[model samples]
Target chain A: MKIFVCVKPVPDTAAKIKVGGGASIDPAGVKFVLGPYDSRAASKAIALRDAAGDGSEVVAVAAGNPNKGESEARKRIKDVLALGADRGILIPDESYENRDPLAVAKALAAAIKNEGEFDLVFTGRQAVDDQAFSVGPMLATLLGVPCVTDVVGLEVDGKTATVKRAAEGRVEVLSVNLPCVITAQRDLAEEQYPKLKEILKANKKKIDTFSFEWPAPAYRVTELSPPPEPAAGKIVGEGPDAVPELVRLLREEAKALSF
Target chain B: MSEFRGVDFFLLDELLTDEELAMREAVRTFVDREFIDNRAIEEHHRAGTFPRDLPQKLGELGVLGPTLPDEYGCLGASSVAYGLMMQELERGDSGLRSFASVQGSLCMYPIYTFGSEEQKRHYLPKMARGELVACFGLTEPDHGSDPGGMETKAVRDGDGWVLNGSKMWITNGGIADIAIVWAKTEEDIRGFIVPTDAPGFSAPSIEGKFSLRASVTSELILQDVRVGPEALLPHSGGLKSPLMCLTQARYGIVWGVIGSMMAVFDEALRYTGSRTQFDRPLSSFQLVQRKLVMMHSELTKAQLIALRLGRLKDEGKMKHYHVSFGKRNNCKAAREVAKLGRELLGANGVCDEYQVMRHLMNIESVYTYEGTNEIHTLALGAHLTGHAAFRG
Candidate 1:
């Protein structure tokens, strides 16, 4: 069985980012990173392949300049490839950087189509940027296969897959078909618990770069603006009075009365 | 010992984000294959030398000199990733790690930093590929802790330098193809990339070692060893050059000590849970619980210190004092944890098969080398108060 995971190189969430002079995300000082959730999804996919034995292969693909030197993004993708992905598919084009989900999804779908056959597709529930959580669904639609978004647990039997998604208050379980897309949620199995030996062997994992036709997409961002900064918070009252005051503010001022 | 302060990788954050999780997984995998099932470790300790081809295996895994700028055939990876790799390597044994430390920080770092253009072009690529074994010569027979007091001298020849000195307790010695020897010239201390094949230069393996037996220890003898001008590291000057190398090694140890301590603690924890004493699991005892709690708390806090320091290193604001603290604290804590682990195991812990005694013995050398616990404390004390405490 052939497994594929859609990984994206993003800004390390731990690193603080400052806006540069232009609309562009200033990568000059930014630390490049593999998306955390995508690592988890990829781990899950690799685990499945390993469980099935030597005939299985885990192919890792990314939606950025996947194998360019000096690009931290590409370096991260390579690191992931080393993590046990049998082969890597890096789409080499700066145009894909910060592109719309539809554009990135199209690039991935085309690669999947080119590969001809795959039993499973895995991806993070959402990329760090904007937290759109749209790529898995978009890719599934483009590939004309079933998709399980925000999946936290997965089980495959024959051509069917039982996926568990973390919902608002409860876990929503859904069964899908083989060759389906899964957006791994953060609540899912941990993405990084690298056993020592695996880290050393990840170097052998193959990473391949590709540049295929993506053509212009219908969707384009009119503007790139920062999300409004959250307003400052202040305590209304102290001690027991604060609780009652918080209730009053929730009921009257903010009108978010959970009680 | 205090909490670990860790390395100052003030520039690693941006570089590590994308591959942090992935690289971590990869390294963990490599460690599992190399260390866990390694048949050579116990034999290595008994034989007193690491496996000859182990370095090549690590190089193939992309771990030998990662984080080095790619020009030198390094991975040019995130500093945190490098630290993580070091930590995992050490979990197996300090002897194994000493090889990497010498290769990466002690040997490769100096060449990358101070070697002449010709030296860098000649030595670095092969070292990264593990085709060449490298050793750092700083500590002398009389100068293990006080490297500045080294009596090694390099006198100028017609177009070269002739070195006269003997370095002591050198790790990865004996078989190193090259050595980064720090010698005090007439005017200043300088680093030299001395080839092992150089006439008058010989490395005799140090015998009768109690700790780090799985690693090679050697005494480097340089009797008027003639070297070309290209051999002298042009950028290295004064006592600071070798001190900087120690800082890098110490920084790596801060994280690595935690890994070893965790392993000892984990083994002890597992053993206590299974061993029945006085009709109860050893873990049921209050004393055992306290030890476990201390080990856990120390491990967590040490981890945080190293992690925070690692962040600083990633950010490009890390300082030597911070690393000094981390080295001092983490090494001391590891020794304590290892001892506690041994105590928890009773007589069984002292045996090789148990592995606690190995760690316990290993931590002793770790404490003494790379700036001893006393040295670090005094350094920190001097930092806190503008005073130099060392006296003849």
Candidate 2:
């Protein structure tokens, strides 16, 4: 079994995000980490490969802007390798900062096809930064395979996989054939913290670099801005004596009281 | 709470290699998840029980005996890497760091350095895997600063040795599977690998006071505990062997205290910035600013010392007195930093919710362990002035 897991490097969720002059996030002083859900996908893919054990291999694939020799994408690939992936492939594009979900998916689909035959592809349901939720379905369409998104549970046997997802308060279980895509949710798999030995060994693993020419984005981000600061609270008074006035203010000035 | 970005005011991170940085980040993330976010330290501290589950988790992270060779299921990490791991663990709690230090430096290091090949093959892998917990028994009830006065005795009977002694202030003692017991023979002081399950071997947990509450401190009592000749560490002899083990642990302490300092300083800094006292945040006051400055300044210096000492150790140029210098300076600095952090927290300082108080209490134990602050000062004084102050 050959499994390919897609990963992306995003600004750390704890980073202090600021808007740059060009309507994009400021990169200065920000740390990048592997996308959280993508790590879940990598974990699941590795577990599947290990369970299938006869010459099975898990290859981590990542695509992003190398960002002036920082090579965050390559670093993320190394992280997945540390998580027990046998090898890695990095697709570096200087223009990736502006690429839409479709363009990114196209790059990944092309790279997966170029890497020879693969039995399964795993990706996060959505990257935390953009939350576009379109890449897994797009990649599957390009590869001509079925895809199950927001997957909370998965079991693979023989050439088929049973995927479980929640839909409208009910679990939707679907059986997908081999050579399909899996977009993992939070509960898809438990995160694996790599051992120090594996981390050291990951430094020695082979990560082949590849480049792809992405198609023109179908949409553009015209402007990006931080959310507006919240309004200050106005103390309406201290005791019950102020309640009638507060209620009047809520119904009139604040318009918070629909009753 | 936001992630800990680390306190690198002097840009000391630039000195670290990629692998070292990655190792630090890995341990830091683990500490956050297992120690801080889960409130394990607070719960265990309140319960007065060691976080017994942590050792296996840390073992899975390959932090136990991390500097040892990979053949024994260790990471064979660099000295700096190991120091960074200690720093991160101590940031979580001093007791947690103490556990790893005792295991790696005091226990595994002795076996790796002096034990016979059979002993190494028998114990190293299991110890590294955290399947076997071991404690070092060198500090006795009557002897601490002066270990030469230890009264533990090992006598030859048949083809084995009968050991009788009592060791005090032993970390991981109560839960340990084996003890690296140092007992005096007629020839010299020797080390023996005594299984805790052996007859007449009993480790009673000591009720701790206010310091290192999350760790177990025990009294190891051995009455005619017998072990085969194979239990002896082949190359260990004289008082110097145990002192050599202390050197390893003290080196880790030099890095570990810095983690406590960083924790308190970070907590205080965050607290002052948001805490209002006179229609302004406490950070706006000049006095509070001074305290914060001092904490940051001292923490930066401690970081530099730890990094330099780690580099020297890796280069094999580190002397025992060099480790003493680091232990003395960093421990004192950490203690003072914790004090100032506690002061800045004011009424809230005593609360466990703030964590400054926890670090403050934990640093007290770190200051006194391995080698007390006064002992290291005397060691350094003797090194510099060619005069021994320890006796007088």
Candidate 3:
């Protein structure tokens, strides 16, 4: 079995983000990491490939600008390779940050098609930075294959795959044939921390780079601003005598209570 | 603790190769996830227990004797890369770095440099994988800085040797599977690979340590312990062999203490920036600002020295005295940085909730071990003045 896992480089969740001039985030001082969901997707793909045994291969794919010194997308692809992916493919797009979910899907579909047939393609349910949750379905539609999003568990036997996903506090299991797209949820697999030997071997793995003619964005981010700071707590009074006043303030002035 | 952004005032990151940076980042991430974020360092320190599981994890990361040849299951990392690993490990705790130093430089290094090929084949891979833990036994109850005065003796028996002596202040001594012991023979001082389970060998843990509490320090007793002739490190001839191992460890200490400084400096910076006083953050005061500046300045200088020494070591240009200079200066600088950090944090600094006090206490052990600050100072003095002050 040959598998492909898609990944994205997003700002580390702990980074203090600042909006740059115009509608973009400042790239300066921000550390980029492999998106958490994408990491899970990569782990699942590697595990599947390992189970498949002889002649099985796992390829990691990503798309972003490469002109910038040490492209983050390329680094994220290398990270997956270190986690046991056989090889990698990077699609360079100078304006990737501005691309919508559909645009990214189109680029990934084109890259996959150009690489020939694959047994399966894995992706995160959504990119943490955008939270769009549309790219997997869009890519499957472009490839004309069935897709299952938010998959928490998976088992493959021969040409068929059984997928488990959570819905309304219940798990829904579905079966899909070969050549399908799977968007991984958090429970898809446990994260893998690559051992140093794997990390060193990854430096020798092949990562083919390509350029794509990106489609015009479907929409634009007009402006970006931080969420408003919460208001400070008000002290209406003190002790037991303040209880009636607090109730009155909540019910009348703040209009927070219906009673 | 928030993520460590690395304190590189000199843009040293630009000077490092991508591979070196990646190695450092891997260790940094491991330290954060395994030790810092989970509060394992603090918990283990308070409980006065070693994190026994750490060795396997660190070995998997390929940091154990990382600079050794890859043929022995090691990473064959550059000198600078190994230094970076030490720096990151010590950033978590001095005990952690000390564990690595003892396992790698003191034990595996001597084995690789002096042991027979069979010995390397038998021990290096298992040690690299952390399946076999090893300790160094050079410092004895009667001698530390003057290891030449060691009284441990090995007597030649028909096909083996009988050893009798006691070693003190041994890191990992209590739990080590094997010990690389330096002993005096009729001919000269030699290294013997002694199994800890030898009939008469005993390693008892020393209690009541106020510093490096997360680490284990023990006394090793070899009472007429007998070993086969094969156990001797064939190439080890005299005190110089053990001193060579000490050189390797001291080189790592030069880098390790810098990590302690980074931890404390970063903590102090974060604490003073947010701590409000007199209608403003404590960082606003000139006094506090000066303290921060001094810490940062000293930390940066120490970093430069470590990097230079690492490069020299890689280039085969480093001397034992060079390592002494680096070890002496960096350890003292780190101690001062930790002190300022504690002062900056005020009462909170004394609490384990803040890392400053922990680092402050750990630096004392770091300052004294692998040759104390005063010993190194004298070593450098002898190097500069062409006179040995080590003797009266």
What's the lDDT for all of these models?
A: 0.78, 0.90, 0.91
* Top lDDT hit: 3
User: Per-residue CA lDDT of candidate 1, range A89-135, in tens?
Assistant: 87776666547788888889988889898889988888795587888
Colliding residue pairs in candidate 3: none
User: What are the runs in model 1 whose C-alpha is more than 4 Å off?
Assistant: A1-80, A83-259, B1-18
- For B152-260, candidate 3 gives per-residue lDDT tens digits of 9999998899999999999999989999999999999999999999999999999999899989899999999999999999999999999999999999999998899
How accurate locally is residue B176 in candidate 1, as Cα lDDT from 0 to 100? 95
Residue B164, candidate 1: how far off, in angstroms?
0.8
Number of clashes recorded per candidate: 44, 0, 0
Ten contiguous residues minimizing lDDT sum, candidate 3 chain B: B1-10
DockQ for model 1 equals 0.09
Model with the higher TM-score, candidate 1 or 3? 3
lDDT of 3 by residue, A128-239 (tens): 8878899999999999999999999999999999999866447899999989999999899986766667777888999998668888899878788876898899988889
The alpha-carbon deviation from the true structure for residue A16 of candidate 3, after best TM-score superposition, in angstroms, is: 1.9
